[model samples]
Target: MEAKSERAERAAQNELLFRAVNEQILQMTERFRAQLSDIDIVCECAVASCVGTIRITAEEFVRIRRETGTFFVLAGHEDTDVEDVVGRRNGYVVVRKQAVAADA
Candidate 1:
């Protein structure tokens, strides 16, 4: 079995990667002066090979980014083994990693 700390680390890493991708996308779209409506965001799941994308409003993305422990994931992509589902939207879900993962 994987150690709790290891799982947490993995989950944190996955979230970090997802956030990096989202930040890049944001920068690319910033110049367009796009309205704060629907935007495409990478899935913030604990799977290294995942390439899924979820659509979320820019305002929603900003809200999720404000919380360090919370991540926006595609529907059904949440890893319940490492995180808890905190909110569900029409096309995405918000997950908060366990405290150990959050600390990492």
Candidate 2:
């Protein structure tokens, strides 16, 4: 039936979209990993939350983080934590810089 064919077509299109999004995320994550290899990397959803080790300076990190995205609806509000958003969306890789401990 025409209806059945239409539904199938829609499903296929949706699948393709999903695949594209997944690929984008994978690519971005890989780039982040490579760029911040000196630090730990955690792939997380914007809501679920994760951590990564970052060797870059705080200024650099802040700049990179700001450039990440201007809009994050999944984060639920303005000034939402990037880690939280990445965790919720499961669409971004976060690079966290671990705090160094002072020697005793």
Candidate 3:
């Protein structure tokens, strides 16, 4: 019973962290929308932790790359074709950074 309670507490904490980060990303997207009129931005949040994926126009991608110092990894490089519509080339997924202390 104690173990179950502990697990539930951890889940709740993770959920709150996820929500906080998701809101931050939404705010950032809104800012992007206001500055650049050419491209569109879409954000996708993960149910677990601070992980998320964002889709932005290719032009937006370039702008974000220039603005932020964050690093990104290439995904969807398998049998799936990465090149498709706006979400494919122009947009990117935004993942939240997790603190080392939180991992414990």
Candidate 4:
């Protein structure tokens, strides 16, 4: 069986992929480049079946990325066993992995 730490690491890695994709999306949008426009990004949840969206501005996204192990997920999608709810905002919440964030 996969260890809890391992599972948490894997989940964080999955969230990282979603973060990368969102970053790419923000970069591609001309409007967001000039102003802080809100965009719908895929939720960075650990669950494979989750298809939730997070509405946040590009500036807010950049602020979230400034911290290591931090990820943005849809409201109520946080995994308390592996992550902690660090911040709450409209439509979503920010989570910080409990540990093993660097593995990703």
Go through the candidates in order and give the C-alpha RMSD of each one to the true structure: 2.5, 16.0, 13.3, 2.9
Cα lDDT of model 1 by residue, 16-103, tens digit: 8988999888777776646546779889888888898998777778877887788888888888878889899987899988784568
Model 4 deviation from the true structure expressed as Cα RMSD, one decimal place: 2.9
> Which candidate gets the maximum TM-score versus the true structure?
1
User: Candidates 1 and 3: which is better by TM-score?
Assistant: 1
In candidate 4, what are the lDDT values of residues 1-104, reduced to their tens digit? 88998888779778888888788877777455666487778898887667788888878888888888888998889999899898999878999887745365
lDDT (tens digit, per residue) of candidate 3 on 1-76: 4475455445445534544554465456666766654433223222242344444444545554442212221243
Q: List the candidate numbers ranked by TM-score, top first.
A: 1, 4, 3, 2
TM per prediction: 0.86, 0.29, 0.33, 0.84
* TM-score result, candidate 3: 0.33
* TM-score result, candidate 4: 0.84
The per-candidate count of clashes, in order, stands at 0, 18, 7, 0
Clashing pairs in 3: 54-92, 54-93, 54-94, 56-90, 56-91, 57-90, 58-90
Q: Write the per-residue lDDT of candidate 2 for residues 1-104, one digit (tens) a residue.
A: 44754543443344334334444544565556645433322222232222322132323333444533221221232122221223232333332211111111
Angstrom error at residue 41, model 1: 0.9
